[model samples]
Target: MRSVPEWAQQRGFGIRVEWGRAGAVAIGAGAAGVVVIDVLSFTTSVSVATAAGTAVFPYRWRDGTARSFAAERGAALAVGRREVSVAQPWSLSPAAIRRAPFTERLVLPSPNGSAIAASVEGTPVVAACLRNYSAVADWLLQQGWGTPARPIAIVAAGEQWPGTETVRPALEDWLGAGALAAALLDRGIDTPSPEAYSAASTFTALPDTPGLLRTSASGRELISGGFPDDVDLAVDLDADNTVPVLENGAFTDHGR
Candidate 1:
């Protein structure tokens, strides 16, 4: 039995955490609610846009120049990479995105992971990361959240190589998912598998190595390549407690 299941067996809660797309897809297919994490920024932007009450038209820029496009359109943009620079303006906080009027459009540029998370729609989409795990869990539990037959799916945006098929899971995303799973288990939910526990534990046990961020594939590629500030922002935990929820075509910090 996995640690989460074991824990759930003892506590009577049914929560589980899984690693990778396979697990996430399984849960999404079976669950009523789904939370996707795109720490790099895409998913975050989607969550923010939805929370702010605007319909999101998620589009990918082949040249990765969405920022400029958004600027040209007078839409607010947030850089999700590490290292903020003077050349880039309109940088704002997650809270600001949540509080902004729902009509404003958001153009988010992250390292390379969050876009997939934006693809999930039919059901309400909420941003999930270590930063908002607790607040999100509380909100979910309070509503007696869950479809009797459908499970909740949490998708973590992993690092993807530009022209390759390889996509690596980031430590932060894994840890964030684990934390969310733990919170769900705390509320009497189903438990995840052994792999989930191992993944979460591995991330949690990291010793905070010097230049660890610089060494990470996503951090290194994005920072050295152009989005230095996004790495730092993505890793920040508990920066915002507001859980953005999707409503109509947009999202609002207001819980639905």
Candidate 2:
């Protein structure tokens, strides 16, 4: 088997940052925990749902199988943005989840964020978004992570190109991961890999987060598709304090 080099693994860092599900796997084993950021909506939806006291199950496939997956767990499945209706109010849109009636549990399927969250083996995973990055750092610190002995990796779940498996790195997720990294550093978890540092710097220097999101490609796509509210809700920075921690196959509130 091929080995992940010490440098590639970002060895000796309290905090590390990498992109996509593959990045999670690359740095996951040596780390104490993983933070998954999907700002364009997966983690954002999770923040909104968990803030409402709902348990969220991350599912990798958004298909007919998702129904069976949710049924097996007795959870309501979140669907596509446009698929949301009065009867099926749960969808990937953070706005939709926020407006929907609260369910005890929800199955949120996404190829990016959910895939990374669920695929991390034997590691604590935290769902992070612009709204709850600081809260996630608080939860991690309380749990004694973000040390050299208990390193944490922040995985930015970038979007996939249409009709392809290729990843198209999104700026929002990068900034979201950076936001978390910056929060950790501000709290004295100063050992960050260069990659994590870059992300942290990017977030720290961001002058207009909401404005940037409004003009981002993902934001423009959502707005053009008539889900401007999703974009709005996504950029609600530091507005939430709920940290959704993935435990036993579901994300539960681990807030301070």
Q: What TM-score does each of the candidates earn? A: 0.65, 0.97
lDDT of 1 by residue, 107-161 (tens): 5544433344444557666667655677787777776663244445566656665
Best by lDDT: 2
Candidate 1 lDDT: 0.53
- Candidate 1: RMSD to truth: 7.2
Q: What is the lDDT of residue 182 in candidate 1?
A: 66
**Tens-digit lDDT string for candidate 2 (54-88):** 99999999999999999999999898988888888
For every model shown, the clashing-pair count is 36, 0
